[model samples]
Target: MEALTGCTRDELIGAPFKNYFTDPERAETSIKLVLSEKKVTNYELTARARDGRETVVSYNATTFYDRDRRLQGVFAAARDVTESKRVEEEIRTLNAELTSANKELEAFSYSVSHDLRAPLRSIDGFSQAFLDDFGSTVPEEGRENLERVRRATQRMGQLIDDMLLLSRVTRREMHMQETDISALAADVTGELALDNPQRDVQLTIEPGMAATGDPQLLRIVLVNLLGNAWKFTSRRQHAHVSMGTVRDPEHGPAFFVRDDGVGFDAKYKEKLFVAFQRLHAQEEFPGTGIGLATIQRVIRRHGGDVWAEGEVDRGATFYFTIPDLHVSCPVKGKQP
Candidate 1:
């Protein structure tokens, strides 16, 4: 009080309480409000010093009573919030600037992808034309070089597409609802089988598995996981893949996808969810390395968590949870 009003205790003791405030009427009304409301908290006022300086103050006041239960007076405390308020405004300004910068970066990425792809398609198209027009005239090595060029172009295109998808995953507006995890897994697995009919993989989906999330995003998660499972187990004579829900001691229920495939090293599991980070050689298993990163973003947006456990050459399991939602729901039968 002495610092705010620039008055000693002796001068403050019997002076009009409102005189030290810029808005005397509001300051006086604040005490009356406490008497009626029993208490008033975080009431804002501007304290005026004797040197004509002002400071922002927050007042918390309560009504007091005498021994006979008669009204006595109001007891109030004031705190300077000038620095905290300034910091809050600064944070708001920084957040706005950050949002603008992100939008600009996203736009730049899209423009670069579009410009690069045009030339890439032209190169591939002309290379194919050359092969078609002068196939016999060109040497075998020359033809192989042309094919390599085409392959590189195709791979670059795929990388661009995947990068765009990863960007969209973070910027997309989510629509949360009760999603059927079992049905989504079944659909994704069925698609994988159709795409590679030669592979005889045993797939199991626990029936009635459900959770709350964006259904479209959740489907992408299943497609990426099940696709990886199917790809990694291509060499196994007896491959097995399954999806189910398990109760987590720390985070309620979690949904899991398990695969008896060429699992990765557990020590490097953290790399699994970082964009463009890969564990295995590109020749061994082909991928853009954006799948798990996308899955982590989706789960996090739903206020949940995702993790993995695996051992090299053994198998792997991925687990994710949606906050406060159950994964076990009753349904008719199993999906295989």
Candidate 2:
């Protein structure tokens, strides 16, 4: 170390070098860069001594040029960051621990699913029994009251199922593969047709679309996306819906679900992907309200993203991305 700085090797070996450093690689690389292309750049590395003491530093190396553009020895300035790096690593470890803890909590919540549903069943059964035993004696309004009790119990059961889904999504397996987006969309459309055959509406899907992701989770995402599209666009005489992709120069490619129906305001976009958040009235739209939240979670778990755009009584488009490795989605092909 001292030899490089014009000092005796023995003296440089034991000096307070932990706070001082010189990167020969930085010097060499800088020299080559200036001679070849002449640019300023920086890099980080560690320097260790014979005694095992070490220093971490980043070298911001630059080339010096004479007014006539004559070559000069590259000058390097280093910033000691051993402590900073240590703290940064500590922060990263803490964050990882926090994420794991969050997952564990979700697992714990899922475990409660078994315990939670039993009581709802008891309530529902008891309510039905009361109606059956005293139906002839009970007034019409009294029978109606029992019906409401049964309805409440069923609703609570549905809520527990929703909770389970939300937790499972947090720790679900992701298998990435090539998928045809158009095929998946077509399959969803066909199933919706069978599921709600009475409804008279047009469901149009663009062709030749593709993507890469976990097929299972992506199917859930599509089901929710298309389901919402179908639900919101129901009011229209001829529902307008499209599925395709767009190229973003800086951000690569993004796939989207476009629909003309009951669109929401831009202000609530962020809240759309949150659990149990519904922008519309329950009377107008019946949902457990966790669909979008689950869709967002699956998308994120696959290392992708999701966003939406819309306005009241206008239309909406939701754009999201997976890995773009494969694509799959066709009507008769409602995922196996």
Candidate 3:
């Protein structure tokens, strides 16, 4: 009691216990409960120190009996829980603040998607109308300038759409279950092949590669990754793309998408996952630079991480791990 209350043991030996309580009425109620129940486990109260500082304590108490079995007094032991209570309060405050911030962000994203895109549509529409109605009457240079303006507005519309998708990926709630990753990858690749049948790309997907995650979000991950691989390998005479899983000693099962295409420099790897950050020129490869960032958010929400390895002009391999899915062996062929 002396160590907890900042009072000397000699001064507290016969002092009234009620005098040390911050709330005398509450302390009296707790005493009554202990007396009636014959014992109290972890009853909480605030005790005032000699210097007027208050400390929260959890007390375990029981009635002390004399030799004749008559109740004499209460015997109790208290453990200080002031620090733990403070930590719990801090956590609650942080959670509330985070929720409020996410709501505000969602509202802002909605405004950008609808309000801003309306004017952009008007700009692109009028530019197209000018070219269609007065294209022959206008000079060649003037007509090309109108075409440039239309293209710029179209690109701006694309940027806005991608930004909304990135925001949705961050705020959306996930539904976790078993997902067929191999089939998803194959579907995305098939779509790419159908869109550009002229390109001859050899895609090898390890069959039956499975994991536990949000099936929808994981599909988005495969689309972006495989889409990038398809786009970058467009110039290759024979493009080679593969999707499979590997066992890592430290990270457990890791999935990868590898492509033999135009790869980026290792020095710029850190910027690969940042929104609006592009390592390659727009003229070389067209992208709004939001795909990898969206993939990173989805993987992180599932308690996983995504990374890449590549050398200039060689190829790139993207690897991600879902820690929640304890997948050990390969679904088909031997591990790579």
Clash count for each candidate, listed in order shown: 0, 22, 0
* Model 2, position 198: C-alpha lDDT score: 68
Task: Provide the clash count, candidate 2.
Answer: 22
How would you encode candidate 2's per-residue C-alpha lDDT over 21-46 as one tens digit per residue?
34555546544665576555556756
Q: After superposition, how far is residue 280 of candidate 2 from its true place, in Å?
A: 1.3
Model 3: per-residue Cα lDDT over 139-233, one tens digit each: 99999999889888988998999889999988988888988887788888989999989999998987777889999999989999999999888
**What TM-score do all the candidates reach, one by one?**
0.76, 0.64, 0.84
> What shift in Å separates residue 270 of candidate 3 from its native position after superposition?
3.4
Q: In lDDT terms, how accurate is model 3?
A: 0.88
Better of 2 and 3 by TM-score: 3
Q: Which is the leading candidate under TM-score?
A: 3
Sorted on lDDT, best first, the list reads 3, 1, 2
Q: lDDT (CA) for every model shown?
A: 0.87, 0.75, 0.88
Model 1 Cα lDDT, one tens digit per residue, 123-228: 9999999999997899999999999999889988888888877777787789888888888899999999999999989888888788878998888888888898
